[model samples]
Structure formats: structure tokens, C-alpha cells
Target chain A: MANVLVNAPKTAKRGSIVEIKALILHPMETGFRPGPNGRIIPRNIIERFTATWNGTEIFDMEMSPAIAANPFVSFFAVASESGTVGLRWTGDEGFVVEERVAIAVE
Target chain B: MIARHFGIGLAIVFIASYALAQGMADKGGTDKRRSGTQDMGGVLQKMQDDDTANPGMLFVQLGGELWGKASGASGKSCADCHGSVASMKGVAARYPAIPKGADAPVDLEGRIDLCRTANQRAGSLTSESRELLALTAYVAHQSRGFPITPPDDPRLAPFRARGEKLWQARQGQLNLSCAICHDDNAGKKLAGVTIPEAHPTGYPIYRLEWQTLGSLKRRLRNCLAGIRAEPYAYDAPEYVMLDLFLMDRARGMMLESPGVRP
Candidate 1:
């Protein structure tokens, strides 16, 4: 599907508490299915996920197929001096997608 | 100005054609291993042989012991009500079966309810509860060696077809069909993890991540939520039908219930 989402306040002042939410779009398929010829389909899954803020990585995950499809992750990140909050998804395909949002410092 | 514009247009055309040619070449040159769906049998086999002793197996053992214990007003055990489970071997492979007068099939949880009401004289166990999972695992384990052969009777045809439809149905915000990822792109890595084919051979598994034993239906519910799809209630007919479809697809694959998995 799609990668996880990270949503938070677009702007925050230094020393403020902020809420961070991340959701990944995944099928988390168990890879036990077979093909038309009935050969066992091999397993392909996302092993890890990570998030960073202004070059400092904050949240990271080691995931399995059991984590389900499109995993939604939510947590908290303290608001320091605002910079760029970057989100990246690395999968078996290698670096599938990345997004960055500029956080305003008040 | 006109001459300059014409030159710019010719340059754009050249660049576009070159890019198109490069894309075609890349497609032919890309490594097949990078395409995903690589063989992982060795890894899976290793995991399977790693150990039979797991916390989930403990739950199954508890269920086996519970089968013989007397409970409820009848003071009768499952063994007393239904006879020896040995006689019922391979019965688990038949479940998620269509009940008489019902439009769809019933899962092991629902079947347990039938037993509770008809034989045990007890209330139905809540869906997704520990007791239900333990009993489901216990019963399914009885059919460990049996092939997953769903009935081919005429009455079952509609539900079986319906179940297959559900498997391929697209739902949720992502607009993804289960087959798209599970069937079409299976074995491709997403976020650094390999995507396993969607199979049901080893379920009611002990997930090291969850640190608890869980059923196939639980995993199904989680998948629905992950896709932003509204989940059917546990033991719901839709889920049963879906389970039947998945189980049939995993036919010939050995059962490894109470399996330990990451």
C-alpha cells in the first residue's frame, strides 16, 4: 500500500510539548500464498521503519508481517528549535518514499 | 524569438526520447533479485525447525487439559459431551463451515459457541478472548496432518466463491485489493522487510512482537485496520468465509499451529 504517516503540529515553539503520529500503509502479507502453478510464494516484508527531525532520528521500528498492513504509529516528540522534520520509508525495495515538512519555530 | 522557441521545443523532444530509451534499457538491465519475490524457503524452514517449545504451545496444552475438565451446570467435559477428540481428528479442517439455515459459514469461534450452547450448557465465549483462542488452537491442532480440504458440495459453492471474491476485493483509504500486494507483489520488501505471501498454514501463532498467542482472525482484523478498512467482528460470517478461502489456498501445506513468529 502506502507508507506510514507522520502528522504533528506544523508549528511549535521551543520547549513545548507536541504530539507526533505516524501511520504506514502496508499489507504486511504473511507470504504463505502460492502462484497459479501452486509453487509457494516467498515472503517479502518490511523489516524496519524510522523517522527523524532536523537530522536527529527520533522514532524507529523493527517490524514483522504480523504488524499488519498499513501500520499506524503514534507517539510524542518535544518541540525544540524548529527545523525540518523528515520521514522516510525503507523497505525491501530500498528507500521507497520520503517526505519533509518545515517546522516553524516561534 | 520564434527561432529560439523552435530550438527549445526540439531540445525538449530530444530529451524526452532519450529518457524514454533510457527507461527501456533500465527495465531490461534491472536485477531480478531487486524485483522482490525471491526464494525464502531456507529461512522459513530454519524458523520452522528452530523450536517446537513456545508460549503459544503452552496455551494449546491448557486447552487440551480444559477439554477434559468439567465445567458449567451440566458438570460435563468436552470429552464427555463430544467423545474423544481422536474421533474428531481432521474435523478442524472442515470448519468455518456453513451452518444449517445460515447464509454464510461459521468459524471455529462460532462452532465453539454451538457446542457451548448445545452441549456444555454454557454461555458463548467472547470472540478474540483467550479462552476462545486456546480452544480454537486445541481443536485445529487435532487436524495437524490433514490436508485443508473444504467441502466440494453444491451448497458450499456460493460461499466458497464469495470468500474468494472477498479475498480479491479492494477496500479502505489505500484502495488496495488484498491480491494486489499479497498475490501480485508477494515476496517484495516493503520498508526493508520481505512481504510474505498471504498464507494461513501457521496461524493462531505466537507473535514475538505481540508477546502473546493470537489467532488467524485476530491477524485478519489487524490487517483490515491497517488498510483503514472497517473490520468485521470476530467470528463474523464474513471473516469465516474469508478464513475458508485462505485455508483452502493453503491446502497441502503442513499445519504449524501455536507457531512462534516475529
Candidate 2:
């Protein structure tokens, strides 16, 4: 398992903002880099990330090659009626990494 | 509601960006790029800082599993003989060291093969091997945060002396010595990139350039090639000698094995 670490308050007041932090393991390889033989290494990077609250999309964005390896992304969503907050990163060759954490609203 | 949500998300983005920049500046030192870990480009730094995000952790995790697996004619698992892996702290830092009765020093990789053949009766794995790298990284990971200490034994004198000479010796058509850049001009700009002091604080590091974990020899070979010189063979003694010298020279620096480098 490419370890994914995420932090979200276990309990939150309804309608309050809940911050989420996520870091995923990845090379985010850019094709512009040259190999030891001086050959250009093919680009391979996470192209998109989406965050959802119980199937309802809260935030999503397109990621480019410049984001760096092992991308660390943070975003906050209103703790409306929480179920599961999920983050998904889709990359080259249809690679997808997803993590989900549940939050309870008081 | 949607607009407010977007506003919070935007603020988070701004915070993340600020943290990213601040992380580099947070490293307090005259030279921020002293270790290989600090030399990483922006993205690579994030990869190395959080273990959850580093791809090299995959190998380290596998190595943890392999540590206790029995193999070869001896049917012995490494753990059976070595006991708790946690006890191995600070051992990797002392390697490329001379084993008892041996005239030459053996780096971690070499020692792995020695254990396999001599103790386990297992066949040797090839250089830059998946299993070998994983095991080496796993073993070395235990020593993370320990200082690299060159043993003061008199027997190691000649090899260290040879290594010292090689560091300053000019080579290749470019006729460049390792000192010219790594020592003399370290921290200065060269070809739009700041020259690093060439510390070996990390080894079996994951270089974004190669996109894989490589031993110190590979990095040395790269330097040789950069100088337009013929690189040594993978297992050459000269490489080992140079590695010994480099490790000793960088003694007392923190070990950051399985590091990420740009």
C-alpha cells in the first residue's frame, strides 16, 4: 500500500469548516527529465484530484506536472452532514489512488 | 454555500503553498543544500519529508516482511540470527567497514551478499537488485538519525588514505577533481544550479533523475561522467574506496537513508 496519511477532525460542529490534509506517495515523474543515458524520461504524474462528501463533490482540481512528487494537498469543507470524506488522485495510465475518512458532526 | 466552501478551499490552498515554501526556509543553516535530502527539487522534498508519501517506503516495507522469511539451505531467517531489527540502530553508519579477518571493507550491499552466501548458503543477488536494495534500505532505515562515525582503527588507514587522494585527483578529459566542485565551489552556482557540498548523509537514495533507489556508487559514477571521465565498473574497488572516504568525510552528519534527491 502506498501509505496515504490524512487528518480530519473526528468530531466537528455541523456547518463548521473541517480541514483535511492529505499526502500520497508518488514520483509524479515529468517526461522532461533525462535518464542516466541522457534519454528523456517519459512524463507520469497525477493529473487530477477530487474530494467528495458522501458522493457530493466539494472540491476538485486538475494537477499539473509541477505539483511535485508525493503530492501534499489540503482543503477544507463545511461539515454540513458528514458521512465519508474521500480524496482520489488519478494519474498516468489510468492509475488511481483513493483514501476515505469519516467525520462526525455534533 | 458553494461560494463559501470555495473560499475555504482557496484559503487552504494558499496555506499549503505557504507551508511548502516555508519548509525549505525552515532548514536553518549556512548551506541549506548540504545533504542529498535538502538538494531535492520542490516536489521531491515533499516526497522525502513524509514517509507516507515516499515511494522508497515501498521497498522498506517489503524488506520488513522479508526480514523474517526463511530461505536457502540454512532455512534461517535474518531475524532468527539478528534478533530484533530495531537493535540494528547505528550499524549501517559504520559500514563499508572492515569485517573481522578481512583486509577490505564491505559496504552494506556487499555485506548482504556475504550474509547470504556464508550464513544462509543462498546464492548472491546481482548488483542494484530489487531484493538487495530493499533489504539494504530496510537495514539502513533502522539507523536513520544516527551519526555516521568512521571507525578509528589503524587497519583502515591505508584505504582511507587512498580514498583521500582519489578525492583530489583530477580525471577525465575535463581534468576535474571532486574537490573542484564538491569542496571548493560548493554552495555556488554552476550551470544555473547551486553546487552541493556532496555529503553522503543519505544513501540508497531515490533520485528523481533516475526515479529509483541507487547506491552511492551510482552517484559517484554520475560525477565521473559529468567530468567526461570513464566511470568505474559497478563493483570496482576504487568506487568502494571513494565511498569509504566520502562517508568518513561526512562523518557526524545525520544519516538520511532512502532519501529523495532531485
Judge the docking of candidate 2 as incorrect, acceptable, medium or high: incorrect
Give the per-residue lDDT of model 1 (tens digit) for B53-127.
244555566677778887676788898967777766776776667766676677766877777776788777887
| DockQ per candidate | 0.02, 0.15
Per-residue accuracy of model 2 over B73-188 as CA lDDT, tens digit each: 99998999998889778888988888877889888889888898889998897888877887888999998877788788788778878988999999999999999999999878
Residue B218 in candidate 2 has what lDDT?
A: 82
Which RMSD does model 1 reach against the true structure?
22.6
Worst 10 residues of 1 chain B by lDDT: B31-40
Off by over 4 Å in 1: A1-106, B1-52, B100-103
Best by TM-score: 2
Per-residue alpha-carbon lDDT of candidate 1 for residues A15-61, written as tens digits (9 for 90 to 100): 88876655444445567768689987666666776778899998887
lDDT, candidates in the order shown: 0.68, 0.82
Estimate how well candidate 2 is docked, as a DockQ score. Answer: 0.15
DockQ winner among the candidates?
2
